[model samples]
Target: MKGRETLSNRFEDGVLALLPRLRRFAIGLSRDRSDGDDLCQMTIERALSRRESYEPGTRLDSWMYRIMRNLWIDEQRARQRRSQTFASEEAGVSIGAVGGQEAAVEINDVDRALTSLPDDQREAVLLVMVEGYSYREAAEIVGCPVGTLNSRLVRGRDALLAKLGEVA
Candidate 1:
């Protein structure tokens, strides 16, 4: 079937095009690079395994994102159950290079502020700001009403501002 072949080729291309963005999203969701890579791999595997479920006319990126989000949530839950720990060691081996001191300090400060946020607020901010999802799309991805997402976003911003303090 030439049509089937064409459709499969298009789908494969679509998936490949989405990989880098998906990895970035996975990194935002995970605590470390290793976990991020694992999440991304799991997402790709799941998406490919369930390719038949994808509607031909629907948004493939959104569908794959939903799968990734669900997987990340599951991993978060498992980590919570295994140990309610927040230590850096619990985050698994670092998979990327650590930056210079100045960069590391900035990153640490941001990480501290981010980790201090409540989970819902963090997810809202990260999804909308870091991952560049629209409000409507982020609300859908997070399975929250738009108003709730707005509230979380506001709170998250305020909290970060407070933690970071005023800058010239």
Candidate 2:
């Protein structure tokens, strides 16, 4: 009992430290601020409940990300089954470091481009480009081959560049 309690406490602390990154990933996955926030909360709750399943010495962030992604995928499937779709609110540009008006506009442009990518590509970009995960790590999280992940990133990056060019 004591061992479990100590593990839970440590897990909770680790989770607290990762909230920002987790929330950002959630928003990226869900494509809406409100839904992302809800997903983040659910992920935290799920992780806490299943803390015993977490392997010590593994990357906690990666584990949490996988949980969040799985939850998002499940939610997407449920929404599809119900034929329910929600309009995405504008991506919140202020989530990043805002230097000035120009920077804010650029950030908004990037966010729009990112959100416009296909789900697979968007996930790849967010995990690799935004979140700084290696290809192998991201592949494991998304449950795809490393080659597939690379292809998605290349396509996503190209699309983003083209979209930004049009804006420019």
Candidate 3:
């Protein structure tokens, strides 16, 4: 009983510590705040239900991110099949919602530029830049070769610079 209690507590702590990042990643993937919240909720539920599958020594953030990414992919496919018009909806929330300040507008511009990248490139950037994962770790999380991950980052960066101008 004590062992189970300790394990659960540790898992909860690890996941809770990552709540902000997880929510932001969820928003990045879904492009909609409501959907992002749903994804975050789903990730937490899955993690709790399958706590035993979590390896104690491994990076908890990576595992949780993998769960969120997989769920996002699945949701995308499901959405694609349901309506071809869904792409239009992916433009995401308005900039005003981020904040009324100028800095928020710049942040929104960056976010919009991020949305312009291809899905693979966006994922690579999210894991490497946003999540601050090492190259090898990001590659592992994205399930791609290191070279491929590098290419995606390069291309994604170039695209962002072009889309958001030199300020990016």
* Per-model lDDT: 0.85, 0.89, 0.85
Predicted structure with the largest lDDT when compared to the true one = 2
Q: What is the TM-score of each candidate against the true structure?
A: 0.49, 0.48, 0.49
Which tens-of-lDDT digit does each residue in 4-72 have in candidate 3? Answer: 899889889999999999999999888899999999999999888888999998999999999999888
**How high a TM-score does candidate 3 get?**
0.49
lDDT of 2 by residue, 1-168 (tens): 999788778889999999999999999988899999999999999998888899988999999999999889867765763443332344344444457789889889999999999999999999888766669778978999999999999999999999999999
Cα error of candidate 3 at position 68, Å: 0.3
lDDT of 2 at 17: 99
The local lDDT score (0 to 100) that residue 166 gets in candidate 2 is 100
Q: Write the per-residue lDDT of candidate 1 for residues 63-99, one digit (tens) a residue.
A: 9999999988866755664463333673556523555
Off by over 4 Å in 1: 84-168
Model 1 vs. true fold: TM:
0.49
